[model samples]
Target: MMNFEMPQFALAAPEIWLGVMVCVVLVADLFDRSGEARFAFWLTQLSLLAGVWLAFYTHWGDSGQTTFNGMVVSDSLAALLKAASAALAALTLAYSRDYLRDRGLLKGEFYLLALIATLGMFVMASASSLLVLYIGLELLSLSLYAMVALDRDNRVGSEAAMKYFILGALASGMLLYGMSMIYGATGSLLIGEIMLAASGGENALLLAFGMTFALVGVAFKFGAAPFHMWVPDVYQGAPTAVTAFLGSAPKIAALALFLRLLAEGLGDLQAQWQVMAIILAVGSLAAGNLFALVQTNFKRMLAYSTVSHIGFLFLGLVAGSEEGYSAALFYAISYGIMAAGAFGMIILLSHKGFEAEQIEDLNGLNDRHSGYALVMLLLMFSMTGIPGTVGFYAKWLVLQALVEAGLVWLAVLAVLFAVIGAFYYLRVLKAVYFERVENPQPLVSSRGPRVVVAANGALILLLGLFPDTLIALCRAAFGL
Candidate 1:
């Protein structure tokens, strides 16, 4: 008798490939113990890039395939977000290299954890089943929980980790309970099946309850208000590079999951959830902007800015138009670049033993390093939604969608809050230009980070001028 086993490698290729790369990074670091680990860092980063490309290359548009029996699914949406996340991961890796080394925190273990977290994001992006989503979410959360504590001797690091883990576990439990309720209600664990069952207005209460619970989890992951109590503390406590990574990439992946799970599968329940979404958006805008006004720490301020941006993102979804969806995706892409560029500049300006993370730290930058100041100025303006920048177009798209969606009043409020948001953004400008500091240190930048800042800043300007190209890409890529 002959027995045959199934070939599972193809189905698990992306995850397994990343795991192997993680091991390779560790081995490389172990063999080379001089602590000049830049080469290992590059290897790890390149592996992430390769893994991201490989996932897309191998998928070949297998959007319909239920790999691992409906666990991992891939499609246009997943591919877009995966590419975005991977790029952000790569950029952050490069941005953090010098900073981490300075802090004695640059290690293969650090990269390995980050890569694993990124891998989990992709998994979550493509999740087709509740079980799979939970697994993906936890994988990312667990890595982050440790990552927050990577600065072993720093007291704030331990505090940040404690807050993150406790809150993360709570959020996870809430999500699981909702998933269980959804399973009980529909008698199925597959998202596709549950969505199908929720259709035609059947099991409305269960679906609604599950959605509320799941949204809580999603909100916590993105650090939205009420659920956002941890963001500023965590951002302040963690090392700057880690905060930069946390600020930039994960939200895009999490937003994709939100779109897929809430807006796609649960599309039928739109009326029920839209109201809840609007409330969250408005509240986030109010709280984030209002509280950010008092922040002295630059990282904490950006953390609040992250929340306000989340609010803007939700505005797109609340529009509930194809155009609205397109707009939100564009915002995600632009925001990722903007956030990375902002933090990249911070890392460039900081020293080996000090964090240049206060607004005052930027004083005299224009006088000392005019070129770097120009990039920072552009990035800050982009964040402020000034014209001739991609951010203007991003905000335009979101505002336009709101108007088109008949949320004119909401749009008005958004614009008003945007004006309020500009206060903090312009405050950065004030320090760089108007305010003066004695004995300023000019920016120190390596080629990689310089190139990143220049390219991102130029892209912001170029895309604003040629909005059609990116707008068209975003339209096509939404594919919803």
Candidate 2:
């Protein structure tokens, strides 16, 4: 007789709940003849809220738990990142509501796709097996590809979708190949087993070669430089609503992917990945800052700005310690909040038939709506790493980690690039306060988006002033 035990499906309650809700909302939207997608929107928001609660409720234990034959894990890190991903997804939808409605792009598909993608992020956060991680990643990527092309009328959107799909497929293939190599070398697909195998040093050259390809895939997902050919074009061509979602929540998922595959599974190969991380960091900082300086498109400028921030995030990873991982997590969440607010500002100022894509679109913004101008001012200051903003502390933590690791020279180089990045952010402030527009239109947006954007700006300064709470949480997640 053979004995078998059932996997603990309760460990993945959040993902399971969200998956069920995706179906429920999809079916509910079919009955909504009003065309406003109100049913789908509210149901999706309810689902996310429930998902967050479930994630915390189910994963609040002190130690990590692996189930489904070690294919999924429930841990402090997964709990925190999963909750953050859900909250950020909700924020993205709140900011996107009016923008989509104005352009007649408000449909159930938008909400449905967002929920599905978020569920994918949740899965990625908890995956303990390489195969499970890849499945989650593909789910997220496919939803995003469709979301980018949601506006079927726009040729640019379709083009961006095609480019994203092709490049994304190539990256996925590389990642799969790398995973196969690692599996062949280690004779296992579970991350814990891979870590054990890597520590033995029996297949050093093969592991290193596999890691190279894996890193390429991770870099592409992060929109990091040398693999970031798709970022600017996608950001510029996609609808602002979609851009807002793309630039925010998926980042936390990317951070999860990096931590799980590189920091956790391949820690023994640090010497190899560290060198590669340095190269990526330097290239990203230089390319991102330099290119952003000359860009006239606000969305494209932020795309490069994202790349530069990724450079700083990489600095933390290079430390290869618990503190370094914690700092990177802190930076990832902070940047996600900042990015949401920055893009939300663009959506807030826009109305029917006038996409606020250009940098000069904000001319005389202070004269028109001082409140919104002040909000944008706070966001720009945060992005510039100004004192009394979260970005400052986020950067500070990364630099501190690098210095602690005795990489003082890299820290100094990062500071230089950060200084260069400040100029473009200041230019945005100048456009808001100093530049004059012929006739500035009144800012028109719903109360929900307005309130969310205001809260988003306030949170940045609040987190900066007292970052210890989030820092402690990050450290706790890593059991440091």
Candidate 3:
């Protein structure tokens, strides 16, 4: 019911800013056709920065305000998640700049695609109606499918593109069908109205079926178990920089959208979805961590690790409380930064013409470059949930929330899996500090990228040292 020219400036500011940015970047690309493409690239970064600011500024004082005829909203949780998405996207752009340029992918259009995708994620986070959620999901999903094949010449990249598109289409179909069923049951597509119908105890069977189908769609989008078959292949085959962006930024946004749709809007159905999430947690943890144990390719291993970490995030969600939600949000934000750094290291270490795809490549790393090896060590420990690292705290919060939810058995399982997870994480450390490879050159980074890497590592230490402030910020944002 909303038009493009609607007077919903307060609600539309983030999308409006991002839309203008897409146009500006495309037009600039026509003028800056120099082979280096550095100017256009930096310009795109600046524009994303503007979009980030617009997200915060427009939503600063608003909470629970449905705008544009019930399409978008500025709620306590939505605002926090949107800011997290922007932060993740901004970091992804900063860390991957050098990598993108090195791979001959220094295109302004790439940034445009990222911004548009990011905008869609925020809209999903703030969606009040099912129609808006589907539109936002597609906008984000379609952009990612194209971005996966950014390296047109790489056959693996093209293969990943096809797989992602075909699978994504199936997910969309399942989701839309579920939405139709829910609409038929409730006679409304607005999430608020559907909640009312569900509460009225009308069409209970239809509601359960619709919820199951919707769970499948969310699982597909989130790379959860059984639906996660495409992720490892996509990560392994895409350009490394694109993989970094895919792993960190888009995933963060998708989690936010999941919370918005499943938790906030469908809160009354917690018993239902919490069970589904627990199953997802167990499956993802088993598949991702165990599969990662045998993987030799470094990026693919990290891809599996990413899936296990998503499982842990779901652990917090199963608690079904405000503290659990906040903890999950914190974990999502911290994990995202760690992911960027881990992949950035891959990009940083690879010299031109080398893919840097093996765990063996990190051996004798300390002998070659003590500083870079140490950074890798820090990242590995954090991912493994070692103390004195943010990863530990993130895992601690989720476990604590699970215990509070009276799910001691699940917590015990988490502890056991964390132990299993430790082994793989240690392999990376063992390769770096203990073993030997024919590392011929020092792990050198350009000054700009070195700064980015150091900043990322410092954030891990800073948050690990004193997470009280950040946790307090999350509390404030969530209106706890």
Q: Which ranking of candidates, highest lDDT first?
A: 2, 3, 1
Q: Which regions of candidate 3 are displaced past 4 Å?
A: 1-6
Give a tens-digit lDDT track for model 3, residues 1-480. Answer: 845655577777777777687787777778875765555567667766776677677776677788877778876567667777777777777766777777887777777787778878877878889899999888899888888989989899999989999999999898888788888888887887887887787887887778778878888887888789999999999888788888887776667667766776667777888888899989988998999999999999999998899888888888888878887888888888899889888888886678888998888888988878878888988998888888988898889988988999998998898899999989988988999766456666789878888888888878888988778766666677
Which stretches of model 2 miss by more than 4 angstroms?
Answer: none
RMSD (CA, Å), each prediction: 2.4, 1.1, 2.0
How many steric overlaps does candidate 3 have? 0
lDDT of 2: 0.91
Model 2, residue 3: what's the lDDT? 69
* Candidate 1 local lDDT, 137-245, one digit each (tens): 8888898888889997999888998999999999999888878877877778888887888885677788789888988888888787778899888988888788878
Please report the candidate that would top lDDT against the real structure: 2
lDDT of 2 by residue, 1-480 (tens): 866779899998999999999999999999999889999999999999888888878886537789988999999899988988998899888888888988899999999999999999999999989999999999899999999998889999999999999999999998998999999889999999999999999888888889999999999999888998999999888998899999999999999999999999999999999999999888889989999999999999999999999888988998888989899999999999999999999998888999888999988999999999998999999988998999998899899999999999999999999999999999999999999988777776779988998899899989989988888888888997
Per-candidate TM vs. native?
Answer: 0.94, 0.98, 0.96
Candidate 2 weakest lDDT stretch, 10 residues: 56-65
The candidate 3 region of ten consecutive residues with least summed lDDT is 33-42
CA lDDT, candidate 1, residue 67? 70
TM-score winner between 1 and 2, please give it. Answer: 2
